[model samples]
Target: MGIEFTALHWIYVVFIVLIIGFMVKRRDTTLICIVGIFMLAIGATGDFTSSISGVFNSFIYAITELLSTILIISIIVAMSRVMMTSGINEVMVAPFTKIIKTPALAYWTIGLLMMLISWFFWPSPAVALLGAVLLPVAIRAGLPALGVAMAMNLFGHGIALSSDFVIQGAPKLTADAAGIPVGDVVSASIPLVITMGVVTTIVAYIFLRRDMKRGTFLLNTVSEENEDSTQAMEENLLSIGQKRFFAVLIPIAFILDVMAMAVFKLQGGDATALIGGTSVFILLLLSIVAHKSEGLEKTTSYLIQGFQFGFKVFGPVIPIAAFFYLGDVGFIQIIGDHLPATSHGIVNDLGVGLAAVVPLTKEIAVVTLTVVGAITGLDGSGFSGISLAGSVGSLFGNAIGGGTATLTALGQITAIWIGGGTLIPWALIPAAAICNVSPFELARRNLIPVVIGLVVTTIVAMFLI
Candidate 1:
């Protein structure tokens, strides 16, 4: 059925436009989103008093929805801190760094390794795993820190996340939305994903190489040796024996975690849960070992620090996410189930509206589906909007006589590539923080390649259909 396009739906659309405009202006949209939530609530409830409560409730709901993601990042960061302190973090990556003697090798090795780890454990956790270890090595090997960040971002967030082959979270969302089997979505995504991945990475890499050749990408303000020396001094408190033991033990532990994930066929939340749980255990064990009687205090201190970092990063994100969460059906339960059952979700309604209004030629359908997917990704949480993409893809496919799986895969590819972290500052934070670069700058660097990839992938998708 087509959407009725209520006043509330129109309001959401207007606010979304405003949000994108604000993003383009490089202005914060958090307060704007909060106000949008308030207005939308007032419109939905039509009671001034109830609408006031809706504002707080929307934020709370947003936090609740994001808590798991925040918590896992926090826990993993805490574990990383402990490993760094024990010097095990350095040890874990030292062996691999030796093979990365040249700048080209540094770029490709880090990118490939990041992709591999991200495929299994997801990118956020993988960032924590490799950031401290691989970053310095890449820097020392003559890879600009920014280049390292790009490799990690493009490979992990762009390539691995867009496909999400090992975990299947992305595929599951797309498949469910499109009313197709997960296997079909995954299968259809392979060529599109590879096309997007290869084109984007190569373009980005070429840009990087040109900059390096021109000396435009040279390390600035921080000599690699000085940075390495500082880190070495900071971590020198740990005894060689202790470092060796933890280094050996930590890799074994993570290897076991990886094996367990494979054995249990765990992906997404389950895999993250296992990783988080293990990180916490390792954090506690290492803290206790290091501080002995004061281990409890140290553990608490570390956890507090981790949470501070996590929540600080999440503060700007929450309000923005709150506004978008309202677009999905998932929020109805939190917003209240007492509303008219006929209320369609904002994103779904928008998709349906597009299907109803747009002319349904093959070219129009392909382009429209890609555009819809990109619009959904503006929310910054790539995973949240994919289901909408899938839904819209299915609608477009049915209307235009294309393969539903092909359309769905195109939608998934576009959504994840844009929102999964490559071009969005909020989504790009993990990689940016790892490489000590500005997220905005990183996003700016990513924009050209990703857009090119999307265009190429969309063209390939039209053929697949």
Candidate 2:
């Protein structure tokens, strides 16, 4: 007989519901979810192992699976820190100040720039560079700070990072889970990303334009304005030569990095590595330029500061990601051996069961899978939910006579775009925090345009795939 819905399945159901409830409550659900998963794993394994050992084992397994991706993220983030300390980040964005003359232009400029930089360096570092440099200009251009934050959140983290066209981290994970080539995933994602980008950007522009017309689009808070003015006064007292040299050199280096990446056809992650490594080198060069003989000591201080900033920006995301790693078979195989055999891979098993029941057309199955991906994304970290989506896509693809790769890609696109930051405040916090806006309010504002764009993107994916 086929497997029944045992105690393990019920436990999984409870945990899933709890997770959903916690997300809605906007509480710190990481520990709760982890505990739930732990209990479920124990029940599945039918082991009376110590809770401590189980937790440690599960954590170790999850961390091992995620170590590479996490380390890569950290390295890039660390490199970004080096750039900030050297003032290269500020120098890189200074030129945009001259071109962004109005709120509408500022929005697009910031959005496009964030997307471009994020494509190379990932969104975490891109936020720092944009927030520190372009934000003041954007604010001065009368773009509402909230709007600027939203733009960065949507374009940088959501669209660019989600697509991960350059680095391929996101695509690699999705493809692995779906059991397809990274190249295929990348190829499939391009049209979907473009469609989503255009639709979302247009919708965002409408909202921003309406606000601009109403004269409510200025995002510069009083405190930040005072801080900028104070810094300006301080800067005016210093000699301009140092600033001028840095201003020119930083941009040149970054431009060269970009050129090299494009000309060499470096993969996304490799391109990010190149950018990050160059940024570090530039940071070192600038520290000497800024501090003269004291450059060595100052550089160390700067590096420390940069790491602190990166960690502050990315730390919370780590644990959240750790919990979600449980859903992946790559990690599950290692940690879930202790789980009752019946409870093993509850997520994938659930997907298989669901696929068995649903007599879906290709179009219907694609839409349903995409919707499920989007729903799973409500947890706010796009990568966390993708494994389940990919697994379900594969199962349903087989059941409904569709391509697993296509369905997985569709699900991946939906999840990343929705939960990656485009529609959720918590997921967009890094961008929002750097832009100095409230994450909740940013999410509220993003609801309409992002949702509309998602709907359009989903329709397009269904027809295309």
Candidate 3:
């Protein structure tokens, strides 16, 4: 509590506000984040060249920290691309169409399936995995394209990604910033994620149904376009039998990996490694089987596609993440040992400092973190600012002397629910595009339900804390 608040701290705080402001204005935060790193470095070391080098160093540190996440997502995307192009994905999702006869059945089935697939591969790849194949089927059954987009967004990006039980990327980032165990964050998130997912999806469905009765949602299949795309993708490199074979084998292999994770009690990096490895194997197997004589070249091509997707997804996140890292262990590494002797990292010290000045309460902490998380998420990556949430949660937890994990989880839920594709038009692109719906319309449809869910989820998190 006696930690000195230095120019470094003030600089960090100012930039945090600037970062949030930039995000709110829908401007790029990359330049500000870089400027922030330099500012902090210069504030700490009082040298020009050192500040310059520190900016680059922070980038290296951020990229190094983020490399594993990038690799896993890339590998999964590559696997998904091959599945989608090879016709295996078509076969894989065919069974669902038979069960999706009614509108209600179609909505729930598609949502649940998307959630399940999202848990394993995460949402982007999950979209690539089966959304295209399932969209027309659900649409034919009377679920509007917007409704399908909602189900996929709420379940896949909202629920699966928020909990991130399999990938653990979300937990790892928050946990590291909060200085807590990944297990604590993951365990604490379960009830909150469930509450949010259930409430939001149900609310969204309710509104969707009400509108359906009025025939508000117009049905358009874009079937010809979809078929044309499919025909173009079909090089017929894979026989129907081979397509069917992979359609069966691919799920089985991933299922086994999931089983192995459970059997070994694997989490975080270990679990991510297992998933990434299996994806690589699947990608290789598919590329070889589908491309035969040119399999090697095809494999590389798929990897390139995957890497492109991965970097594109994460590229916006890196700079912001780098700037936030300095609030934790990254401080000493990037800017040298310049913090006050009593300082317990910038974020931790801020927590202590705040607690010392204010009469902190769980209620206030809950609302503050919820807002901070949502504000940070205005960037729409949902990921770029979770470290800030973790930092702030850690801060408040220190002030209150408990509930770090709960607060961190709450922040994660809020941020991801807001910007992870549910209410954000741009973030909704994958599901929207796949379902042939307007992303803005999808976002508008999601707003009420998501807000209701966030309110409910925050209350639940309050009780947990």
Error of 3 at 192 (Å): 0.8
What's the CA error at residue 17 for candidate 1, in Å?
A: 2.8
Where does candidate 1 stray beyond 4 Å?
A: 1-5, 116-149, 160-193, 207-237, 337-346, 361-448, 463-465
Model 3 lDDT, residue 366, Cα? 94
Which number leads on lDDT? 3
What digit string (tens of lDDT, one per residue) describes model 1 on residues 207-236?
888888998875652345535532642464
> For candidate 2, what's the RMSD?
4.7
CA lDDT of 330 in candidate 2? 38
lDDT, residue 135, model 2 = 70
Cα lDDT for residue 27, candidate 1: 64
- Rank by lDDT, descending? 3, 1, 2
Local accuracy of candidate 2 as per-residue lDDT tens digits, 320-414: 44444454453455354543455435545555566677666777877877777777677777766665556566666656655666677777877
Model 1 TM-score on a 0 to 1 scale: 0.76
The model with the greater lDDT, 2 or 3, is 3
The TM-score, computed over Cα atoms with residue i paired to residue i, of candidate 2 is: 0.76
In model 3, how large is the Cα lDDT of residue 134? 80
TM-score per prediction, in order, is 0.76, 0.76, 0.97
List, residue by residue over 49-94, the lDDT tens digit for candidate 3: 9899999999899889888888998888888888888788788888
